[model samples]
Target: MTNLSQNSDIADDEYLSAFYRCAYGHLATVVGTGHQPSRTVEIGSGRGLARLSGHSWWHSDVLPSEALTLRNSAERLPFHDQSLDALILKDTWHHIPDIEAFLDEAHRVLRVGGTIAVFDPYWGILARFVYRFLHQERWDTRTPQWSFPSTDPWDSNQALTYMMLRRDREDFHRRWGDRFVLTEYQRHIGPSFLLSGGVSRRTAVSGAWLKRLLSWEERRGPWFDHFRFFHVFGLVKQ
Candidate 1:
């Protein structure tokens, strides 16, 4: 197809592109609307967000790439205290080795009222099953601490988001409630992610059909606790 991408870093398939488009669009509204983020930075950004830069932001990751605006670890963001207006993460929060450490840095760098918006794998019933068995990432909800063992930065717990925001929210609030507030939580994404095979594998789902699925999910997404696959949650620095 003429629309197909040749870059190894960006989603090549139509369905995956549509998914990222919808997901990142939702992310933009949270990080962009109601407030102007003069210094927005997206961590573990990969290359997906660069394709749709209607708004402005810096892309960052631990590994340097032609696509990224900066290179730094989440646990130790290089920006000065309260310097950034917002931070965003897409499919990257789960990869953090230490959620608390990253949160600490997130709190330090983000100005008061700065938003941190993320789109990541959810822990609904179907999502839990899919992430634990169908996906290759680690998915342990039983881990006693927020940090996991990982020499490789890619090692991750797919359940990290759920663990912190849902299962152990009390602990999170107790530790850093005064600094950050979970302001938005919308858990929904149908089989579009799996059908597209993400950026790693390709499936031939047409863009039109993918749009229908996403539209359907939008109307009937309240079943977030059971059937949905992904979540878009936002935190505001307090």
Candidate 2:
């Protein structure tokens, strides 16, 4: 996993900046805005949603950062049962070595009506191609089990989110549906992001122009759905 500059205003190209900014905004809206309680926790603090949110959020990460409120893995949260009102995960969800274990911990920590917001990669046409062939991470949709063997926190399956929520949704429900409800799911397009070259390089314009391009993508909707690269989904504990 790329260590996104922890500061909200990292030196990202305008396109990438808008892309991540929207994700953090969406995440903040879900975890805050009276949708959930105030004791919210964002698991990945690097480029955290706390900066965008109006509410105070406890930040945590597996990485050793003095800034983090908690330095822990997803599978083993240190909070007391039902002590948390919400849990937010950005790009970190796919890197967990055990999906079932993490979900179990998530279920244990959050209150009955608590929310879990996830902002991660989507399996759109352009995303599938770029992640599988161009990106360094593994994107295997065919993996039968949710667990992968990875000792390194950076190791990941980019398809993990897509698999649990889209492809193998039935399997997920069969296993954990009774404990959680899928309250919201929305796809996002980032064609301009392709040119921004992420954090590695730059080509797409930034600032007002990049914001305009992103607005254009949202306005176009279905016309660009095939190229969507990320999604924001919320789950409510039951």
Candidate 3:
């Protein structure tokens, strides 16, 4: 198996190229149908996919990089009040040290009726097993709270998203009721992520097979919601 680094160019590798194609295909669908904001920004956007969907987006990350439009933390956005129409966080919220502060910032910057779309790992049985044994991240679902005890911006508890959206969903609604409204929540893409090998591992499936897998997933995803590995959520600022 080949190791693929996030910084390295992935277009040359057939498997990695196919992997990104399939992954971005799902994200593109969300951008096209779910929320198409005129002015949007993606937090923690490492080699962003917003451009692929033909959306005008400003990319920001905690670390400075030539690829990013801005260097900023999620907790403190540099934009003005009600300046943005949408905020997209793909696989990012889990790494944030303080999610509440991040959400507050998102609410402050987004106009009323503006959307916050998040696509992240969902802690299902297979996902929990994979994260615990195969991945290099923490997967403690019983971690008393969502926020991890870390000052580093990059430090993370991968299970935090699952806990907040699935286990402690009501708590999230109760706390953020005044600021935001949960619009859409759904489990998606069961084994496709594993087969893709993500950004760090060798791909296990071909591009053709991945497309077939995604099509199959679309038809039967709801039936196996309990076993799906990812969550796509949409929230509107109120």
Q: Ten residues in a row with the worst lDDT in model 1? A: 1-10
**Residue 209, model 1: Cα distance from true site in angstroms:** 1.9
User: How many backbone collisions does model 2 have?
Assistant: 0
lDDT score of residue 227 within candidate 2? 85
Q: Rank the candidates by TM-score, best first.
A: 1, 2, 3
lDDT per residue as tens, model 1, 90-120:
8899888888899889989888888999999
- My TM-score estimates for the predictions, one after another, are 0.90, 0.88, 0.84
Best by the lDDT measure:
1
- Stretches of candidate 3 above 4 Å error? 1-8, 12-38, 151-153, 203-207
Q: Candidate 3 at residue 3, lDDT?
A: 22
Better of 1 and 2 by lDDT: 1
lDDT of 3: 0.73
Cα displacement (Å) at residue 170, model 3: 2.3
Tell me, what's the RMSD of every candidate?
3.1, 3.3, 4.3
Off by over 4 Å in 1: 1-12, 34-38, 48-50
